[model samples]
Target: MSDIIRRDPRAEWIARNRLHPLHAAMQPVQHSWMGPNGVIRKNVHGVGFIGPNGIKRIDRSGAQQGGAAKRTAAVEVQLPLHQVAAPAFYINVVPDMVGGRLSSHDRDLLGLARQLAGSDGAVLAVVFGEHKENAFATAGVDRLLVLDGHEFDGYSPEQRVQGLRAVDNQFNPRHWLLPDSRSGGGELGRRFAASLKERPATRVWQIKGDECIGRAGAGQEDLARPLPRLILAAVECADPVSETRHEVLPLELSTALARSLPRIEDLGAVAVDPAAIPMAEAEFIFSGGNGVKDWALFHQTAASLGATEGASRVAVDDGFMARDRQVGASGTWVTARVYVAVGISGAIQHLQGIGACDKVVAINLDPGCDMIKRADLSVIGESAAILQALIVAVEAYRNGAKRDAA
Candidate 1:
C-alpha cells in the first residue's frame, strides 16, 4: 500500500487506516484533489492550453503599459462643439420626376435635411409641382417653395438649372442638397454646380454627425467633410423616426422668376422602351453577365420575377445588351433592394455599382467566383437551368398566394 502511494502522505495514512473494516466502511468516497491552501486549483494557462503548472504570466514593458493608459485617457476626452459646422441655410431641390407625390427617395432627402438642420438652421425644399401643404408638412421641412405651371411638368436640363439658379439667388443658400437619382436630379445637380462654380460631390451615401462622407469622382477613396457650397446626395432609404419637425411655410412662386426663364423648344415626348425599367427606380434587378447563354430566357425570368433587366459591361460591349442597360462603374450605379446576378462574374466595377444593394443572389457555374463569395445566397449550377427552376418556383408561389387570397 505504501509503495502504491509514494507522493501523498495523507493517501498513505488513509490506506493504512483502511486495513480495518470499520475504518474503510466509515471513510467517504472522495474523487476531487484539493490543495493544502483549502482551494481547488483550476487548469488555466496563458497559452489557452493547460500545462503541468497552473497559469503562465505574460510580462509587459512599462512603456507599453503607459501607452495603453494614454489611449484610454484620450478616448475619454470630449470633442469640441466648434468642430462641426452648422450651415445657415440648407436648400433641397426636389426632382420633377416624382410629380406631386413624394417618393421614398424624396422622403430620405427630407430626413437628411432634418438631420443637417439640427437646432440652428432651416431646411427649405424647392418642389416642382403643386402638392397638398399637409403632404409637405409631414416631411419635416421648414418651408415649401412650389414651382407650379404646365411648363414645369416635363424635365429639361437647361430649364431646371435656370430654375435652381433663380432659387439660389433668392435664398442665397450656403449648402445645396440635390437628389442624385436618374430622374434628372443628377444632371440638374451637375449643371447647377457648374453654374455656381462649385465642385459637387455626387452619390453621397453616409452622413456621420455633421460630416458628410461619400465617394468622390471616379476613384474609390471615401471623402469626408462638412457640408460644402454644393452637395449632391443619392437617397438610399427613408427614415420614419426623424427628430426634427416644423410647420411647413408654403411660399408662392415669383412671377418674375418664372418669366425670366429661357424658352426651349419642347421636343415632343420621345418613345420609351416598354420592356425596360429604369435602373434607379427598380427595387429588384436581374442582371446577366457573359456566362448567360439565353438572353430570351433571361428577359422571361425578369418578367416573371417583376424585376428590371440589367447587364454587365461585357454583355453590353458584345452587343448582347443595350448600352443603357449596362450596370458598372463606367455605366449606371444601381441601389436595388434585391439584385440577382445570373451567370455574372462579379467584376470590381460591377461590384462598385451594386454596393448599396441590400441583398445579392448569385447563380454561377464556378463556386469560387467573386459574385458567389459576395452574394448572400449562391446557387452553384448552370445559369439557364437555375433561372428556369427559379421562374417555375416563383410562378407556383404566386398561384398559391392568389388561391389563398380568394
Candidate 2:
C-alpha cells in the first residue's frame, strides 16, 4: 500500500489564514456617517460607506421616460483608529465597452501604485474582482489582491459593508481610491471609514489637505491629522488625440503632487477666474479643436487675434493643453463677445458650453457639420489655411483701427 501522503505544514497554514477565526475576537471600528437628516452622526464600529453629496430617488412626477438624475454632494465619511490594522486603498476597475467588447476604462487606474506610494509608507490596493493581469501591470503594480467570493459578487448596500469588513481583516491598506461614479464605490468607502475609530475625509474633487480643510459635522472640530489617510474616487475622461490620455495624466499628477503639493492655479484642479455665467466681460476669444491638429497653427491663430487661447476636451485630454484651457461641457463654459470655432465640428456637448457667446464664427472644411449651422459667420475651407488669410485681413483691419484712434 502506498504510504499515506502527509500534508505539508506550510499548506495547512496557508489554508488556515484564508478561513475566519474559529472564535470571533470581535473588534469594532468607529467612524461618522452623514445621516438622512443631512448631518454628520456617529456610526461606531460598523461597515464603511463613503458617500458623495445628494439624494438619489425615483422621480415619478416627471413625464419623461428616463426618471433618473445624477446628483453631486460633499464628502463626509469618518472612521476611528482601532478598527483598522493598517491603511488600505480601495481600487475599483471598470471595463469600457466599445463595439460590445470589453476594454480598459480609459486606463485611468493604472496610476494606482504611484498615487499611493507617497510619504505615507506602504499602501495596499484592494480590487473588487478579477481583471486582466496587464490591467494593473501598466500602473507599475506587480501583484494585486483580487477579492472574489460568493459574497463580493452580489455587491448590494448590505453586502458591500460585510465584504469590506472581511477585507479589512485580510489585507489592510492605508488609503482607498475609487472612481467618482454612481456605483456603491463611494458609499463603501464612507461606510468602511465609519466602522473605524479615526475619520477619513471623503471625496476627490476637492482635495482636503493642509491648504484646503474639510468641514466636519456640526459641533465637530476641524480635526487635523498628518494629511489624514484619504479615501477617494477618480474618473478618466476622453483625450483628444488617443485612448491613452487618462492613463497617463493621473500618473503625472500623482508624481508631481507627491514631489510638491501643487497650488490651486498651477494644478488646474480648482476653478480659476471663471467667466461670468450670463455674459463674460471679454470682447474677443480664440478657440481651437481636436481638428486644429498642428499646435503651431493653433497658437498662431490665437496670437494674430490677440485673444485668449481656449481648447476643447479633446485637446486637453491629449495632454497638449492643460485643464484650465479646456472649454466644453465637462470643462469651461464661456460666454464671450466673439467666439471663434477653428476646425471645430461643434458637437452638441461642445456647443452647450459656448452657445451663450454673442458672435460665433466657424472655420472648417465641412460646412455641413453642425458647427456651421450654429455659427453667425461660416468660413469655408481648411482651418489652418483660411486662418492664415484671415490673419492678414485682421492685421490690416487692426492697423486701420489704430490709425483712426491716433
**Best-performing candidate as measured by TM-score:** 1
Q: Cα lDDT for residue 346, model 2?
A: 70
Q: Model 2, 297-355: lDDT tens per residue?
A: 77776777667777778877888777777776677666565788887877656776674
Candidate 1 C-alpha lDDT tens digits along 97-171: 353556546666776666666556767888775664355555666767877656666656676677778888777
How many clashing residue pairs appear in each of the predictions shown? 0, 37
Model 2 regions more than 4 Å off: 1-281, 402-406
Q: Rate the local accuracy (lDDT) of all candidates.
A: 0.66, 0.48
Candidate 1 overall lDDT versus native:
0.66
Worst 10 contiguous positions by lDDT, candidate 1: 75-84
Cα TM-score per model: 0.46, 0.32
